[model samples]
Target: MGASSPPRVTGRLRRTSLVDQAIAALQAEIDSGAWAVGEKIPTEPQLVERFGIGRNALREAIRALVHSGLLETRQGDGTYLRATSEFAGALRRRTSCSELLELVEVRRAIEVEAARLAAKRRSDRQAAELERLLAESAAAWRAGDVGRLVGADVALHTEIVRASGNAMLLELYESFGGAIAEAIRTELLDTATYSRPTHSALVAAIVAGDPQAAAAATAAALDEVRIGRERRSIGQPSR
Candidate 1:
């Protein structure tokens, strides 16, 4: 027997790995708008053939995306694209508080400079806007509207950064906006530490065009939030 023809080296090539193929195909479809938000995706078998993958591998890829919040599944219905996938989820998952504190430290550095610029460059209109946001914040606290208070707090800080008239500073501030907002909501607004007087001081400092005062006021407010978080931690019952 003629040495069994070197185990039949088939000319047909194997395609990419199943998981990568599935991810690539799905990503392309999403990028092309083939799978728009709220639109159900094709069944598993369909994806298997489309990406040339086995059932198990295809399911694994889909499950990964689902966990990432890029895809949502209903019990009876098919999977669909989520309207929005928060990048913050990834950040929170990948980084510990110590890692994030480094980022916050950087923010402290930039915020000081931003406050200085804001004091020098803030227009009358910007000052008025900051005042309005502060007023709303005070009103929200008095009315015990936690949600509204958080919104006003974010708006107030954002306005102050915007008033700095430095696009780069504003962009840096925006990068942390979501994290800051969540922090305020959970630590400040949820606790009784935040009060009308705290917001009033911040507003007054910004309106007075005093960079040192603005920085000092913000530091104080954040100190209160930190203290609140520490208190909650201390109050937690032993597991």
Candidate 2:
């Protein structure tokens, strides 16, 4: 009798067996916080037994997570978690310094227009909110809390964008906030001395209901960001 061919590896079964299921199972463990950040995962034997997966499948899953920045493997030690959320991990892995600088420019474009629109359209309540946010941010700056200052600065500008009365514009700004914050935090300590007055000038323009002044303030604020980025790029001491 002719030799029987080995079992064919059908596409459907292969799809179900190795790649997708392993990735999904591992990612679920991460998303559910089964493994906390900086915590080491189970050894290969334990994972293989728990998941009923072979060493090969478990290794593939580990490799995928490491590539995604969710985990890191030490040469001698076990794999360790690097981030809490997948999106945050992926964002950290993907964003380069040059890309962050480009994002600053994008923020400048959105915020400049939003400031003008806000000056023209903000209601009294929105104006009050802007003032309060700016005050919180300035206080954070004066307290030498760069972390809190970054949060407040993002909040105040986000509020200004909302006051523009354009839903789409607000959505875009909200989506980009994470990336912008990452960029902002890089030089925030060095730039804090300038940021307080720059943000104050923006709030002043918005409150005065002068579109031209608001636009100019936005420009000035973004210029400071640009200068900060350039200093970091060239390794100059932040003034």
Candidate 3:
């Protein structure tokens, strides 16, 4: 009999589970402005030692930040931080209702396209999820719960965008997540009516997969919200 071949040895993949540590180290550097936009990151070996992790784990952490658009990598050059907006500066600048209206107008443009795409491309699973969220929104409105209503509203619109099956559009929407949520809370929740037929109409249009009707219903709902804000402003005593 031929000599039995030596049992093949399979070495387990060695990896660091210290993902959080690596993320924290890099986040601290970014927060401290040590890594400015366009600045190339340190080499993989350097990062491994700096973050005290195996090369594989460090690479994974970098990959996560890259997906979030905070970092970018070049095939041969190096990874670099992407330019980020200074949200603090934006907050410091006062914004008027007119500006808010313009923001809503932009949202309308984006959402109209999203709704159209969703109507044409959404899978059965996505449609069902949209219906579920709309039902939740209706229940919240009937209960006069602004918080729940706003949450449901955000989820419903997010689902619509997701159903559009456009990665770039979805990414753009996610980038504005915080600002959009705040806008809904300050603008819509403050003025939304519990008995508004427009609310139901919008949900119905989305459920029925009627993109044009969805767009119209959304516009109408926003119009009423703008009117409510105006009325509130007029009713307030002069400061």
Candidate 4:
């Protein structure tokens, strides 16, 4: 006879963002069939006790899972399991600020050349779209809408890649869009200042057909963003 499988044990979460860690753990449990679809999850007290997390933290985790469609809440009934798994769910894991800064660096590496090529080859339509996206990004910032800012930032960079006239470069940038948006959203939290090489300057360089200036402006802008994130992480004021 085959040996019996060992009893399952949920690991204790360490000190960090308890809500985020709880969300990850609960999602894994749902994926592993610890809670089947259509079945209600444990009571709030049970979950809080089981996870050794505060009530507020566990509730926030449940709320996030509900938002992600992995779970659903009923009116005074209970939260029911929804999805067993999600494609790219692991990619949605909460990233450390430093890890997100690394993603920004990677994205900058792609966009620097993209900006250079765009300066050399942008069409009138691509230039117009880039300008529109920059305006929208600035508007979103002024309105304190981080979500809109993320979308606008992605759109502007995407337009630059499109203007590069290189299908492979555009494809590469497309693949990184979602992760880049996630990082940017995290990095911009509580950041009231926009970085150097303002959108206008970058666009002006591209409009002037100056590849070197465009690339330099792109580097400076992304480096400023990176520095801002580093400062945020260390609790230092951004320069």
Residue 223, candidate 4: how far off, in angstroms?
0.4
Q: TM-score rank, highest first? A: 2, 4, 1, 3
Which candidate number would show the highest lDDT if scored against the true structure?
Answer: 2
* Residue 142 C-alpha lDDT in model 3: 84
Predicted candidate 4 versus true structure: per-residue lDDT over 1-239, tens digit per residue: 99999875545444237778788878777756697444689999998888787887788888887776667799989887655444222333437786778777877889899999999999988888888888898899889887788778878888988999999998667655545666667667757555523677898899889999999888888888888888889999987
Where is model 4 poorest over a 10-residue stretch in terms of lDDT? 85-94
lDDT agreement with native, every candidate: 0.67, 0.79, 0.68, 0.77
TM-score for each predicted model, relative to the true structure: 0.59, 0.64, 0.56, 0.61
Give the local distance difference test score of model 3.
0.68
lDDT tens digits, residue span 107-192, model 1: 56766667667877899999899888988987888888887887788788788789889998887676555556555555553456
Cα RMSD of predicted structure 3: 13.9
Off by over 4 Å in 2: 1-95, 190-194
lDDT of 1 at 204: 75
Where is the poorest 10-residue window by lDDT in model 1?
88-97
Q: Which order, best to worst by lDDT?
A: 2, 4, 3, 1
Error of 3 at 119 (Å): 1.2
* Candidate 4 structure lDDT: 0.77
TM-score, structure 1 vs. true:
0.59
lDDT of 1: 0.67
The alpha-carbon lDDT assigned to residue 181 of candidate 3 equals 52
lDDT of candidate 3 over 60-143, digit per residue (tens): 888877766667789989897653333422421224666566656666777778777777678889878987888898888788
